[model samples]
Target chain A: MLPAHLRMLARLGNGEVTMQVDGPVTQRSILDALEAQYPMLRGTIRDHVTKQRRPFVRFFACEEDLSHEPPDAPLPEAVLSGTEPFMIVGAMAGG
Target chain B: MPGVRVLVGTRKGAFVLTSDSGRKQWEVSGPHFAGWEIYHMKGSPVAPNRLYVSQSSGWFGQLIQRSDDGGATWEPVGNAFVYDGVPGTHQWYDGTQHPWEFKRVWHIEPSLTDPDVVYAGAEDAALFRSDDGGLTWQELSGLRRHTTGPSWQPGAGGMCLHTIKLDASDPNRIFVAISAAGAFRTEDGGETWRPINRGLRSQGIPDEDAEVGHCVHSIAMHPARPDVLFMQKHWDVMRSDNAGELWHEVSGNLPSDFGFPIAVHAHEPNTVYVVPIKSDSEHFPPEGKLRVYRSRTGGDEWEALTTGLPQQDCYVNVLRDAMAVDSLDSCGIYFVTTGGQVYASPDGGDTWSAIVRDLPAVLSVEVQTLP
Candidate 1:
């Protein structure tokens, strides 16, 4: 699942994007695969140079906030096995 | 009918307003890239149909959009704006040395002779140029590495290189202005630059007549005489006769001179336009009135053009890049207010009418007179 703005920007239909992760699906691996699949989403989700997640963007899966997790940490088993969709969210913050 | 296309960048999205030569009966299109901040949209001087847009967001970062068929459709171009080399530090808001960081693009200036070449002015005050249309960009780097780079600080707004003027008579010469950093001129294309701020004065700075740190709001020049320039500083209206070598106060008879966005007439190089707000702190017209002041003799003397503008109980600001003029025989002047009003003067500021009301707080406006 993705934000409405990011969905429109990536031209994805009204559904979750499923990609084939080559190896163990960590946060870094999933993000690297997603960015490789959709090049335009590179800087939108993370900084171009520092590669840090943008301040107002969050990641969630299995009904838990995984935004603060280390990039090398393994995602929830449900997210890795495709039982639960990884969610990219725009934080409920400023206007 | 010779028509005009008015490209407007607003707080929420971008809008394109089209009209026939009469400048009446406009057709407005978009909220293109809806729910995004469109900072600026500009067309190529050689190929008017080729357009470039700066689409950015706090959460999603910066993206460049390009249009080939006059903004009917757009494609995302390059978004990477990596600073050159070490990306050194400049003065931060707290008067401490902070490393330069890329935030967003404030302006996009396409080359005069090529549709494939373009320039972008970015926040944190840097310049980038793209040669292969908009596919990639490289920083000029010399401007940021100037000797006075450490002393530059942000104005009320973030430190942004918001103005880029390419001299038509000499392709190698280009001029750019930054908030609180004053103006700079490059003689050998983008290789070498020097601060050209001799005669400008600002009260708040340590030295009133320092080389940099004047906080230039906007700058304008007529293509016919690129040597002469008009500037709307943070408080005063200024003019330079020798290609920005020395500036002099031209605030003369205006009720107030603290405003953004100054423009020159399309055909008459001697005529100029400025919207004077009350003061630096209060960014609105004086006496609760909205007026567009015109000077037929270039600078000192000015006349308030409020025939169709509101003369009472109006408090809205015209931002630094919101005013633009079209090159029609009759000469059309257009500007957008923070109140979401886009006003047009079809006959050279003699009278005015709102082209459209209730937009998303326009950030910039540019006009293209189409054949």
Candidate 2:
């Protein structure tokens, strides 16, 4: 889903593409970096005016849900180590 | 070589169909912003290559797109449409007060003289204008803040301001139409407004002919004769000769006037067009026929133009913004369906041909005649 959104930002379709976002890289910093690089994705994850996280979009890191957590909260070490992509997943509803 | 480019906005994406001056063969490109809803796309009348498209989606909200090289490439512009001051409230579906909300851009009309100046009509019924292309938009709040604002109610389509007509004869005069709220006109650009639904009759409403709430589907005025106007109301085809101060039923002999997208002939001020659906309950053509009725004498008499169009077993609905006219040596009429077929009539509305089929259920259609 992150790749799909990155593609929406016109940043994909290149071979061995690797995007680097510098510094502390908390959940909030990482998202801010991503949105900074892909301005079109600004409102796709949050709102344009309100900056509120869309109800259907969720965030996760270190095998834990961090969607409702504060923006400045630190992520688990595995995410920052590049072992897993701090996941941005679409929340599922209605079985 | 002179040619025509047909810009189509649909539920799933945007498309550009091109043809030479002959209006015969066609080359189609796109599904740009694929999987997104392209409510409307129109090219600058003066700078024909400059184009503006309203791209939106439920997952991503709204995004305005601009293209400088025709439709070859596009870049995202500003999508922020903040209403001026306290947005206030309108009549809700359950007859309660509901705050005005921004849904999406329904129509984009570029200025006739400038490429960067454009107007956008939005849902929850508001008008916005952008001078620096579509990067940033500011609401022309005088229309929304009018004294009658509270009483305005949403039609089945959620109270969208879908039509914006700038008076070519008078720069300060602008007209806009909102569903379930009738039509409004402003003489001082967009600072002040007045409702222009004097003679419309909607049998479904409580008072039938209230000052507002008429559900005006679309309105059209030939630039040569701006005083004389044509409208496709929710239930009747109407015409007014005195700048919308009053209107009279011109449904005349139309099989059914419960249709959208009324247009005027490019060359003939008195000639008009309307696609008559069966009724409010049945949006498709009458007796399953896809015929565009042309009224050469303005409004009264009508004749069905079906050449090359599906005559039977056809049931596609044309939206208010899905029809347009291209100014060429011979006027051309184009209209698309909810079923994804774009039909063209090079000789006005006498005959029709499907330029492209199985598109993404077109939401709007606009044409630019390239010189």
Candidate 3:
């Protein structure tokens, strides 16, 4: 049987985009894949050494707020099952 | 049809002006919220009766006032609206545990779709959100958690939430620009946020760390094309066709590249407006020229529109929220200056005329047309 694909929803300032990934993904793996695919997005999603989510960027999986969650934490089971979606949101405002 | 009403927020207070049919005669109102330094005043899009003003008093601290009777009477959102310092956290610059205690509210923007949802930016580099109509607010942890180290310093005025742009199509989608922290966006309300500062530039930073948290003063987005956006940085006017994924300099033709405000036409996505000021040294209109420039093709080309503006020495700096474009099909472009003058261009900035002058130092400007 083919592994489930997680639907990842990413929202930037101007618009929103969605992508799909096969397998139960951790935050680190997902970010790695994203950085590998879009080199311009490498330093954007997470910090280089700490691998922590950037200040203006937040992560959400299965409706749970994962902004402060550790990067290595396993995503929710619903996301693993491909029934739930993971979301990455951008911070709004300049102060 | 009733002409557009322009709300001018000034250092002393707030004022209102209504234009005549010919877009000539001006009826000006009081210095409402007088004696208080008005940082920003926004006329609610959902309810015309609601006008929100953010004020800062040196001895009293930051306050958000609401005027239901159209700037006639005002009341604070309650004592809960006050901005006290965070518990035990000290700011790096001044080493003050709570710099917000002495700070001012720079901008107050209420969500157009949800009038009850409001956001305020302060001088201490903090962003606060209120769901219950400004009665209370919670600090967005996402910004507080951002660690830029000691070198990620704020600009002259300090890190602040100067502007907040909500996706008209999706209320949950919001964009915010910070002075030294750069720009950020959130699509799922405030639960999570991402830095959309790609293609943006910092003064002397290398290519690697340039996009993360560069200073951004103002941002303008096309109503129809969410993917297209424009921003006024410290040194350049930039546009991103891919929603800030990458940005390119669009102020090539402008007289000056340094500016605080940028506005887009209500109906035309390709048409935009910005008031250019000289760079850090001069920080005034280019060669003392009081004119507003229009970009008809997304900043590809710009044309100076100065029909009635002063041709002589006119040193003025338009604040980030001082310039506005009306929602009418044949939009009316308006802007106020720090020199206490308001200029209006009825035919989409093709020509210009001064509506009011010598009132007070204008801080922010908002325009609304009553039915």
| Highest-DockQ candidate | 1
- Candidate 2 scores a C-alpha RMSD against the true structure in Å of 2.5
lDDT of 2 by residue, B1-371 (tens): 98899999988899999998778899999988888889999999889989999988776678888999999988888888889989999999898999998889999989988889999999989999999998789999999999989999999888999999999989889999998899999999899999999999888787856888889999999998989889999899999999999999889988898899999988999989999887767789999889999999989999889899898899999999989998898999999999999999899987888998899889999999999
Tens-place lDDT per residue, model 3, B97-162, is: 433332567888888867777888766566688887777777665654554322345677776779
Cand. 2 Cα-lDDT: 0.87
Q: Write the per-residue lDDT of candidate 1 for residues B1-371, one digit (tens) a residue.
A: 79999999998999999999999899999999988999999999999999999999988989999999999989888999999999899998888999999999999999999999999999999999999998899999999999999999988889999999999999999999999899999999998899989899888887867999988999999998999999999989999999999999999999998999999999999899999898757888999999999999989999999989999999999999999999999999999999989999999999999998999989999999999
Tell me, by TM-score, which candidate is best.
1
TM-score list, all predictions: 0.99, 0.94, 0.75
Candidate structures ordered by TM-score, highest first: 1, 2, 3
RMSD of 3: 18.5
Q: Each candidate's DockQ score against the native complex?
A: 0.82, 0.40, 0.01
The order by descending lDDT is 1, 2, 3
Residues A1-95, candidate 1: write the lDDT tens digits: 88988898889998479988988898889889988988888899889888889999999999999999998898999998899999999998767
Please tell me what DockQ candidate 1 reaches. Answer: 0.82
- Report lDDT (Cα) of residue B142, candidate 1: 96
Interface RMSD of each: 0.7, 2.5, 18.0
Candidate 2 residues lying further than 4 Å off, grouped into runs, are A1-6, A14-28, A63-65, A70-74, A80-82, A90-95
- Clashes found in each candidate (C-alpha, N, C closer than 3 A): 1, 0, 25
Structure candidate 1, residue pairs in collision? B180-B215
lDDT of 3 at B44: 77
